[model samples]
Target: MLTAFLRVFAGEGHPVVLFLDDLQWSDAPTLELLRRLVTTES
Candidate 1:
């Protein structure tokens, strides 16, 4: 879900401000993917 949002945000050429409500509830892979998204280019 977050990856799709990131991809769409990147494709639209818009900056994103993600406010995760319950980050602790997120799975490890999802968190890891978000980390990669921040470090890597779209």
Candidate 2:
């Protein structure tokens, strides 16, 4: 599932921005996944 998103957000040449909202209502696993994504370069 994460792999599929990485491919979609590849951005070919431009840039890709990933935005998330309602963090107060988010679960632990969701937050953990977001943390990994934020730390990754590509």
Candidate 3:
């Protein structure tokens, strides 16, 4: 679900701002993917 949303945001060429309300509650994989997304240069 998140991946699809991100894909659409990227497709639109708009900067995506994700507000993760609670990092502690997030799954490890989701955090990892978010890290990769921000660090990656497309």
Q: Who wins the TM-score comparison?
A: 2
lDDT (Cα, 0-100) at 23 in candidate 1: 83
Write model 1 residue lDDT over 16-42, tens digit each, in one string: 777768888999988898798788766
Residue pairs in candidate 3 whose N, alpha carbon or C atoms collide under 3 angstroms: none
Global CA lDDT of candidate 1, please?
A: 0.75
Off by over 4 Å in 2: 1-4, 11-13
User: What is candidate 1's CA lDDT for residue 2?
Assistant: 63
Off by over 4 Å in 3: 1-13
- TM-score list, all predictions: 0.51, 0.61, 0.53
Q: Indicate which candidate wins on lDDT.
A: 2
Q: Deviation in angstroms for 2 in model 1?
A: 7.7
lDDT of 2 by residue, 1-42 (tens): 694578676766966676778989999999888887777765
Task: Write down the lDDT that model 2 would get.
Answer: 0.76
How high a TM-score does candidate 1 get?
0.51
For residues 1-42, could you state the per-residue lDDT of candidate 3 as single tens digits?
556667666755577777777778889898898887777655
Alpha-carbon shift of residue 10 in model 2 (angstroms): 2.5
Worst 10-residue lDDT window, candidate 1: 4-13
Instruction: Please say which candidate is ahead in lDDT: 2 or 3.
Output: 2
